[model samples]
Target chain A: MSWVVENLDLIGRLTVEHLRQSALPIVLGLLLSIPAGWFAFRFRLTRGVVLTAVGLLYTIPSLALFALLPPLLGISFLSEVNLIVALTIYAVAIMTRFVADALSSVEPSVRQAADAVGYGTWRRFWQVDLPLAGPVVLAGLRVTAVSTISLCTVGILIGIDNLGYLFTNGYQRQIIPEILAGVVAVVVIALLVDWLLVLAGRALMPWTRKGA
Target chain B: MDLFADAIAWIFSPEAQSGSLPLSEAIWTHLAFTFVSVLIAAAVAVPAGWLVGHTGRGREAAVALSGAARAVPSFGLVLLLVLVFGVTHKVGASTTAFVLLAIPPILAGAYSGVEAVERRVVDGARAVGMTSRQVLGKVEIPLGLPLLIGGLRSATLQVVATVTLAGYVGSWGLGFYIVQGIQIRDFAQILGAALVIVVLAVVLDLLFALLERAVVPHGVAARRSAD
Candidate 1:
């Protein structure tokens, strides 16, 4: 407790940095996954290949991916972009499957109804399919957000400097409070973001609200 | 190109093969850690999950617990445990952390797998004069095997990846190279170590996928394909 109090300023800065690193990849991943997921869902021929490939991306360990990315992408070893990019790849890998599954979860009868009412492919997807898939996609996003926040701590190994620093630094200096602070701060950020996402989901998709 | 070239050379170098902690030894240690942790986690989680699933009790709590567990950073957990237990117990501490990390997925898999079995099937087993234990062992367990295996698959992947961090605590594993490389600013060593870990993870994942497939009952496989 004293260790955390004494390092409050450092903790605050690291928490903010941790949020920054995690948020970018999550947003980028959502943006990319929607299109990629749609393509995989809509196109029967490419579905298996695309999903499998993306799924394989997730099997690569985080530390390994963090280490390999800079060289693969021609970035500097310590560049923050490498971490962001690696995290985004992970986000995309995870969310794309969820997105595809969510879209598939939409009833065939609903699509037929949309088509009969003269909704074009683009309009049907935007107005009907997207809305219907929102709940499941949100669920996936929540998982991604929590995992990403937790994973961002790994960036400390490369000297990217985030709450994860507390773990390494605390271990080196034998400051248990510092390590506990990192863990609590990370879990708080994840839960807060998750709660916000739930609120946003309700706000954006009122039809999904309970008893609506 | 030079970085990759250096990494490739380092991977094949005699020093990497004959060092104080040889590459092969690191691989074995990583596997042993992963195996033991996951086995311990499964032993604890599986029955608890089965109890929850079979009796339809404590499920929400179990799920909520697992969800909370997911948000814990594996890195922080390992380091905290090591510090708490002292450096001499680093292996026990990290293994405990790994077991904790592995439990949620296995528990989720176990209960969900059992729950996925049709109510009618269990009822039918009961109608035939089978005992509760018999129904669970024969009906629920067999049907739930695939999902339990799936849970084990994910748990294995998580543990394997995490065991790499044990290197940070001065433990043996491929992560030692990454830790050592980072300290020395040896990009080649880091990359080479990363490549090996990636290969190990992917290969293990594939094996699990195959195992998951093989464990599925023929009737269940046929019914799934029919769907």
Candidate 2:
């Protein structure tokens, strides 16, 4: 308890850095994923190969990817670049599949109606296809956000500063209170992010709310 | 051509052979450590998940807790555990990390499965005066089994990656090879260890897929295509 009170500022700063590290990759990944997913949807084989590669990338341990980066890019903040690349690879794969599934779930008649109305492909995609797929896309985004938060913990192991550093430092010093503070801080951040995503999901797709 | 032959020759040479026992033995120990933790975690997670899904009480809290657990790195958690429980404790960090790993998937699977059970099927069961337990046992569990197993498969792979972290804490495992390979700059050993992890994860996922088919009614997996 005294540890928590004494180092409140440090802990707060750690949490903020952690959030910043996670936030950029997640937003950028999602933004990049949406269009790539849509493009892949139109080109089926390309989608399969890209997604499979991404899935394989997901299995590689984060530390290995970080370590491998130094040889290729001379390390530094470039390590974070590799981390984001690896994470984005995962996000794009998941979102691609999600987008495909959601699009398929859209009834055939809806597509027919869009065609009948003479809407061009791009306009129909933005207006009809995406809106119909909102719920699923939102769910995929939730998973991506959660995974990004989890993977950010690896940042500490690679000498990057984040809340995970607290865990490592506390453990090194055998200080239980400091370790608990880190764990609690991470848990709070995860929960808050999860709730925020859920609320955003609800706001975006009011239709899903009606059923539940 | 000579370089390739020399590399192969060295790989099968006497020194490598002498070092084989400790390396293979370490791998076996790591496997044991991982599987034991996974088994314990699965046992705890599965029951907790079923109960949470069955009763909606504290469902949000369970989800929140699982999310939080999933967010922290198992390696980091292991380090903390070693500090609190002492390094020699078998029930220390590895077990906690695996348990933490297991909770999220089981909870996600059980809750989503229960939630996804068709309303009509549930209503029909209730209309027949079926008890809640009967509805769950007879209808919901069977329906949810495939997706639940899918989640378990993913969680298992996660546990395997985590087991490699045990080396840092002085526990024996495949991580021994990975860390050693790094220290010695032996890319071949590093690749060998990583390949083992990949193969094991793929095999486990395939096995779970088969188990899902065997346990669930036929066509259920086909129906849950995205899962």
Candidate 3:
């Protein structure tokens, strides 16, 4: 308990850093997956190839990806960018499939109705397809957010710092409370972010509130 | 490019193949850890999942538990368990963590696989005088095999990746190279070991994909392709 109290400032700083690291990759992944997923969905020819390739990206272990990225990207071994880039890749790998599935889940009849009402391709997608797919996409985003936050901790092993520092430091010092603090902080952050995402989903998609 | 070449060269170098723990030994240890943890996880999870799915009870609990499981960082879990179990019992500690890490996916796969079977199909089996035991064994298990394999695939991949972290707690595996390399700043060793882990994961993933395909019921496969 004293360990946590004395180290509150350090914990707070690492928590913020962790959140910063997670937020970028998640937003980038969400942005990138939209187009990548749309391409796979819109082009039947590319669906198999794109999804397979993205799935392959996920097969690479997180540690391996962290180690390999430096050499592949010509970056410094300890560069924070490597972590961010790797996390983004993973986020994209996960969310693209969800986005693709979500887009496909939109009712064809609803799409036809939008088209019959003279909605152009661009407007129709914005006003119809994206809105309908929002729930699933948001669900995907929640998964990505939680996983990315968890994954960001792995960055500490490669010299990039975050809440993971506590795990390593606590282990070396055999400070059980410190280790517990790290675990609790991480789960709390994940659940908190997940809850916020759910609230945001509710706010943005009022029609989805019917069941609840 | 030169660094990658060096890593490739390092992987093939005599030093990598002839140490207290050779690359080959590390690979084997890594595989052993993955197999044992996954095997144990399946043993516990499959039965529980079957019960939940068959009885149509505790599904919400299962889903919530898996969701919570997914959020717990494997690295932290490994370290914490090592502390709880003591350093001398690192093997047990890490194995327990891996098993816990694996159960969620396998459980989800097992239960969901059975749950996914058409309700009418199960009813027909019952109507035809099949016992509950017979329905589960002959019907749900066979039909859910593909999804069960899928869950096992994810669980195996997760355990394999996590087994690397076991090295941080002084356990031997392919991750030893990565952890040691990082401490010593040996980029070549780190990259080489990482490549081996990647290859292992990819190979395992492909093998599981094949298993999933082979296990898909003929009717299910036909329906899928027809869709």
TM-score of each: 0.97, 0.81, 0.97
Query: Where does the lowest 10-residue lDDT sum fall in candidate 1 chain A?
Result: A70-79
The models' CA-based lDDT, in order, is 0.91, 0.70, 0.93
User: Predictions ranked by TM-score, top down?
Assistant: 3, 1, 2
Q: For the second chain of model 1, what is the TM-score against the true structure's chain B? A: 0.95
Instruction: Label model 2 with its docking quality class.
Output: acceptable
The CAPRI class of candidate 3 is: high
Interface RMSD, Å, model 3: 0.7
The runs of at least 3 residues in candidate 2 whose Cα sits more than 4 Å from the true structure, single-residue gaps closed, are A8-13, A39-53, A67-78, A105-107, A196-212, B1-21, B54-58, B122-135, B180-192, B219-227
Best by DockQ: 3
Q: Model 2 residue B112 lDDT?
A: 69
Which digits, one per residue and each the tens of the lDDT, describe model 3 over residues A25-124?
9999999999999988888888998899998999998889988898778888787999999999999999999999999999999999999999999999
lDDT of 1 by residue, A1-212 (tens): 78878889999999998998999999998999999999899899779888888878899888889888887778877779988999899999989999999999999999999999999999998999999999999999998999999889988888899999999999999988889999999999899999999999999999988652
For candidate 2, write residues B1-227 as lDDT tens digits.
33334434544556544575354565567667667766776677766777677777778987776656666757667777777777668456567777677668767877767767888988999999999999989888888887788767767777777777666566366665656665676655554555555656556666876887787776765777858
Two-chain DockQ for model 2: 0.35
After the best TM-score superposition of candidate 3, give how far the Cα of residue B117 lies from its true spot, in angstroms. Answer: 1.1
Q: Tens digits of per-residue lDDT for model 1 on B1-227? A: 78889998988889889877788999999999999999999999999999988888999998898888878999999999999999899989999999999999999999999999999999999999999999999899889988999999999989987888778887499999998898899888899999999999999999988988898888889999999
